[model samples]
Target chain A: MINRTRYLTQSVAKILIWIGALSTIAMMILILFQILREGLPVLHLGFFLDSPKNMGREGGIFTTIVGTVALTAVAIIVGAPLGVGTAIFLREYTRESKTSRVIRFGTDCLAGVPSIIFGLFGFVFFVIRLNMGWSILSGGLTLAAMILPTVISTAEESIKTIPSSYREVSYSLGGTRWQTITRVVLPSALPGIFTGILLSIGRSIGETAAIILTAGSSLVMPTSLFSPSRTMSVHFYILAREGISMKMAYGTGAALILLVLMVNIIAQWLINRYIRHRT
Target chain B: MAMKEKIIEKILLLTAFSSIFILGLITFFIFKEGLPLILKIGIKAFLLGEKWIPSKGLFGVFPMIVSSFWVTFGALLLGIPLGLACAIFLSELIPPSVGLLLRPAIQLLAAIPSVIYGFWGLIVLVPLIQNHFGGPGLSILAGSLVLGFMILPTIITISEDSLKALPPTYKAGALALGATHWQTIWRVLIPAARSGVVASVILGMGRAIGETMAMIMILGNAVKMPTSFLDSARTLTTNIGIEMGYASGDHRQALFATGVVLFFIIMALNTLAISLSRRRVH
Candidate 1:
């Protein structure tokens, strides 16, 4: 009788677990499907080519797209070098010491600081204090700070995976430390590091709070680093919030989703290829 | 060559310290902007006073603080079960091939912007809640549901990692001792991985609390204390996000003070999570 009850309990528990897992997956699919169904019709070539008009009630999101691209480019250019250098220092130049631990703790804490806090800092320090005004430079620098921890951690993890024997081989071959890192370790870690950069790009593309504060919500085409601009995420937020035009919001959201999807797909493919090649 | 290596090392070390330097500057500026207001109003009045009118010089954030906790608590209630289920499913129940496919799907869920989530909540969830629950669609309930989903990836990924990190002998020994699969998971494996699972939940709480744009979209800008999930409310993040554009003088300082409170809360949670995970490692 006890054994019978045990089997029944297990079966019931299993069913509940299956329901929980399936519902989560179903919810994800439903969100994706609902957005795409409403959004795909609005996406066209013109939507990508023309700038907005009439407070974003009409016209396309071309300027927002440019803003997103420029902002992401600046973030990657500034953030990637700093992040990879930090990772290299952590993994190659330092041992497990107080200094390394403090740096790691700082990175982790920075990761936990919310995006809005970064926006506040950018507004005060970059926009006001530094006299950058509401421009792409301020916004991009804030995003770089926001994505710094992610890049550092990913780069460090990848660098840590490179076999020590490779470094030993380089040294035995009379290669300098700089030469070994540049030619051997970094090359082997490229796929992983590249994946991190891709992930950061995706993040920079979607960030809204920091962008709106530091970049200013200008719908005009961003001509230079000093010009104020609007990103797609910020554009979507304003449209949907103020009830400007639901259709344009859907289009912008669709475009943003597609961009993120493309990034994740590329990152996943790279990771899979790297694993396969390694094995 | 040696000299070149030394120079490169110095550069890298400077880079390594950049994050710390940036963090210090962020804290310093936020406090510098915020601390004067707090001192002027008194910390107790700023934190515990119920009113938050910036124009009249009332700058208390008690209601927002309450709403932030309530919304985050509601999110945790919904997210923890779903996340644990998915984590267990990925770590134990599913085949590796199936898990591989599902894993990226979760990562993609994370990659989807918070604004998109906010958009979805606005379009679909608010109306659903209004029609069925008999309240304005923009309630704490709406915010919670959206945030619940937003935090899934954080909870699932970390919990699954901890579960996967367990020694194989644990499962084998439990089974060999005649424990059923469910029994082994519930009585042995989960108990063993408790620290990690707890850490994931804490981190999820941090994410839910720190979330801004989505809450600003779904949670209506009611400043009064929320008595129920049906009432519209605002969070600390939404407060800062909504008002920063037009706010100046004491009002602007008040928003930064709000951010100061948020910053401390997140740092505390992060330190707790790090300590918990460190315990798991040993």
Candidate 2:
């Protein structure tokens, strides 16, 4: 009787677990289906080429695309160096000492700091105190700061995975520490570092709150670093929030989803290639 | 050559400290703008006062705080069970090939932006709730459902890793003793991975609390204190996100003060999560 009861409990638990797993999968598919169903038909050549007309009720998201590209470029350019450098210092230069521990703690804390708080800081410091105004420069700098921990941790993890023999070989060849890093270490760690950069790009592309605060949702095409601009995420947000144009909102949302999908796919490909190459 | 190397090392050292420096600056600026309001309004009134009228100089965030708490609680209530189950399914129940396919789908859930999730909530989830359950649709219940899913990846990934980290001996020993798979998982493995599972929940709670754009989109931004799951309410993050656009003077500072509270709360949760994970390691 006890054995039968145990079997019954096992069957029930198995069913519940399957339900949990299936529901999560179902949620993902449902969301993607709902979004793409509404969003995909709106996509076209003109949709990618034309700039917005009334508020965001009509026209393509070309300007927002440009703004996104420029902002992400500045972010990657600024963030990648600092993040990779920190990783190098932590992994290559320092042992697991007090200073390294402190740095790691700071990075972890920074990772947990909410994006909205970053927005408030950006609005106050970048937009006001620094007088950079609500421009690409201000927004990009804030995003760079926001993505630092992600870049740092990814870079550090990749660097940690580099076999110690590689470093030993460089030292035996009488290469300087700097020479070894820039030549052997960096090249070997390139795939992982590149993957981190792609991940940061994906993050910067989707960031809305911080961009809206520091970038100041302007419809005009930005001609300079200091010019205010809007991003696709922010544009979709405004369109959805103001009840301006559901059609356009769906289009923009669809576009944002496609862009994220592409980034993830590319990142996945890179990881797979790296793994295969290693093995 | 050695001189150049020395200079490069120094530069790298500066970069290594950049995160710390940035954290300091963020704290400094937020506190600088926010502290005066907390002092002026008195901590008690600012934090506990019910009304949040900025024009009349009333800057109470009590409602927002309460809403944040309830929304986070509701999210965890929905998320924890599903997330734990998913984690267990991934770690133990599923075949490797199936797990591989499902894992990326889960990560993609996280990869999708918060704004998109909110948009989905606004369009689909809100209407469903309104039609089915009553209330204005954009209730705390809607927000929780959306956030509950948004936090699934975090909870599942961490919990799965913790569960996977356990020795196979535990399972083998349980099975050899005639314990079924369910009994082994329920009575043995889960207890062993307890700290990690707890840490995942705590971390998920932090994510739920810190979420902004999604909450702003779905919560209906009602300033009044929330009474139930069906009530529309504003959270602290949304409070800042919605108001900071045009707020100036004391009103602006009040938003920063809200940020200060959020900052402290996130830090506390992060510390707790870190310590919990550390205990698991030991």
Candidate 3:
């Protein structure tokens, strides 16, 4: 009786494993279907081009798209250089010591801090304390901080992958540490570094809570960095939660999903290419 | 040249410290804002008391705390079994060609924005749960379902990596010793990858607990201890996200206090994960 039951349970576990794997695929498809089905009907050229006229109840999302692009641009400009520098410093400037361990611990903690906490930090530090107010700059700065850990970790991993032989060659030629990193090492790790940037772009684009607190939801088009604006994600949140118009929300959701998938695909492709190139 | 390189190194070093600075600022500012409320209200009442009314000035996050744990527990119940099974399927059971197709889907699941998940959950899962499972539908069950899906990628990826790291010899030896295929896997491979699996589950737990945007949508936003999976609940993340907009003075501080609690929970989980993975490597 016990052997028979064990056999049955083992077979059941095997079958359940198939279910688990297939269900993941089914879930992804279901999400895509729901987004496209509800959203595609309302999407049009006007929806993409026109600005929100009545508190996102009517018209398209022209300004918000621009705001997202501009905001992401600022974040990339601020975060990318800092992240690359930090990765270089961690990998090259010092040995793996207590300082590096602390930095790693700090990065891990930063990565795990809830998005809402980051939003709170941005609200107090940027919006109120720094007098940036509800602006794209504040939101972008907040997102930079949030995505910094991802960038640092990825960039560091990529930089680590570059063979030490290249650095040794540079040093044999009497090159300084800075020369070795900039001329020989960074170029080799460029694709991987680019992948990190793209991943951060994806992260910053999808982020809502952090931006919502820092970037005040303004109906009007933003005029400058100091102007408040709504992102597509934040816009979708309001429309869905407020029960404004499910049609528009679905449309925004669909667009946002497409953008994210595109970004992810590109980043994945870049990573693969980098790996192939390295090998 | 030496001077220029020294300057370059200094700049990079400063930038390297920038992330640590940001982390410090976040912890300091949050504590600066949140500690006042905790001190005034006393730690016990703040953490353990069972009431949370901003207008009445009664700040007790016990309900939200319990709700957060339950939701995370619920998510683990759904995510871990499926994720671990899926990890085994990919690493040991399935062919590479099949894994090639399925793996990207899991990664795509990770890349999809939290708000999109929220919107989808609001429109699809919430109504489905409401119809089938009853209640408001936007309850602990719905949140768990969404969170379960959200953590699958994290769990599956790490678990699969750990499983893959095991030597083929282990399986070969088990089969050589007259063990059946399933027995070899069940008894040997799983026990070997235990640390990675635990780390994956802990990391997934961190992801589930800290998730804010998606949780806010399907969790029904009820600040009460849920008696059942179908009951409405609020998590620490949703509590802060929903109220931080217009919250002023002590109310704002109270939300910061909620963030502080969340920080500790996430920090603990991350530390545990790092230690587990560290041990696994050794």
Candidate 4:
């Protein structure tokens, strides 16, 4: 009887695990199916080619796509160097001291702060107080700050993962700390740093509430850093929430879904390639 | 050469310190703008009052506080069990080959963006709730469901890491002593990973509470205490997401105050999560 009960319990546990895993997969399928069903009818060549017409009530999100790409570009330009710099400092410059602890703690806090709070700060400091207005520059700066923790942590991790043997070899050759970092450590850690940047790119593209509040959502094609622009996520949000055009909203939503999938795939590919190269 | 190295070091240090400065600046800006309004409205009224009309000079967020807690608690209820189960399966039950595939799939779920989740909830879950149960469909249930899904990745990853971190000796000892596979997992492994599992739940709670766009789309955004799972309720984050666009005067500052409240809550949760995870490491 005891043996039989043990058998029954083991089977029950197995079923529970299967149910959990399958449910996760199932939810993904359900979301994908619903999005494709409602969104694909409106997705077409013209939708991708044409700019918004009548404040996004009609027309494709060509301009919106351009805007998203443009904002992400600015964000990378602004965020990457700073993020990498910070990571280098954390990993290379100092030992595990109070300052390093404080920096890490701050980064963790920044990571946990909701995107909307970031939005409020960006709106107040960047847009209003700094007189940047609702522009791609403002939005990009905010996103850059928002994603700094992610980039810094990942970059720091990558730097830490590089075995100390390489650094010791460089130092033994009479190379200065800077020389060793720039030539040996940095090169070896490039792919990992790049992994962080790519992940940040995905984040910058998908961000909405923060961009919506800071980057004024204009339908016009963005031409300059200071020019106001709207992202695909924000475009989808404004359309769906305001009930401007459900068809366009669905189209944009579908496109947003596809964009996220593409970003995830590309990022994963880079990470995998880096891992394979390491091995 | 020494000068050049020194200059590079200084620059790197400056950049490294920027995040700390930014944190201070954000806290300063939010408080500088928000606290005055809270003072003007009186602390008691702002924290304890029940109304939320900006145009009417009423900026009470007590209902929103209640709503945020309940929704997070609800999401935790829906997400933790499934996430823990999934973690166990990935770490113990499944082979590494299958674990590799499903693992990235979970991360992919995390990367899908909140706006998409909100859109799905709006389009699919809301109507399902409405037709099947009642009350315009945008209830706390929908919020919990969507937010629960949003947080699954975080919970699963952390819990799996915790479980994997356990030394295999415990499992071996249990099995050698005639414990069933299920008993080994239930009696031995899960207890050892307790700190990590608790940390995951706390972190998941943080994500669920901080989520704005999805909650805005699903929760009916009604400013009231949720009496049931089906009741429409507004979260603190959703309140800001919905109103920060056009608010003016004290209304705008009150929204900033709303942000202050949110920032504090998230900070607390982050601290708790950090402490818990730190314990796990030790």
Q: Specify the highest-TM-score model's number.
A: 1
Q: What are the per-residue Cα lDDT tens digits for candidate 1 across B140-190?
A: 999999999999999999999999999999999999998888888889998
Cα lDDT of model 4 by residue, B70-105, tens digit: 989888887998899899999999988897678878
Kindly give the stretch of ten consecutive residues in candidate 1 chain A with the minimal lDDT sum.
Answer: A270-279
Name the Cα RMSD for model 4: 1.4
Winner on TM-score between 2 and 4 is 2
> What are the DockQ scores of the candidates, in order?
0.82, 0.79, 0.71, 0.77
lDDT of 4 at B259: 88
- Residue A269 of model 2, lDDT score: 76
TM-score of every candidate's chain A: 0.97, 0.97, 0.95, 0.95
Residues B183-250, candidate 3, lDDT per residue (tens digit)? 88889999998999999999999999999999899999988878999999998999999998889999
True contacts kept of 2: 0.77
- Overall lDDT per candidate, in order of appearance: 0.93, 0.93, 0.89, 0.89
Model 4 segments beyond 4 Å from truth?
Answer: none
The better-scoring model by DockQ among 2 and 3 is: 2
Assess candidate 4 and give its lDDT. Answer: 0.89
List the candidate numbers ranked by TM-score, top first: 1, 2, 4, 3
Instruction: Spell out the clash pairs found in candidate 4.
Output: none
Decoy 1 TM-score against native: 0.99
After superposition, the stretches of candidate 3 with alpha carbons farther than 4 Å from their true spots are A1-12
lDDT tens digits, residue span A1-279, model 2: 999999999999999999999999998889988989999999999999999999977889999999999999999999999999999999999998999989988888888888999998888899899999999999999999989998998788788888989999999999999999998899999998998898899999989999999999999999999999999999999999989999999999999999998997787678768867876
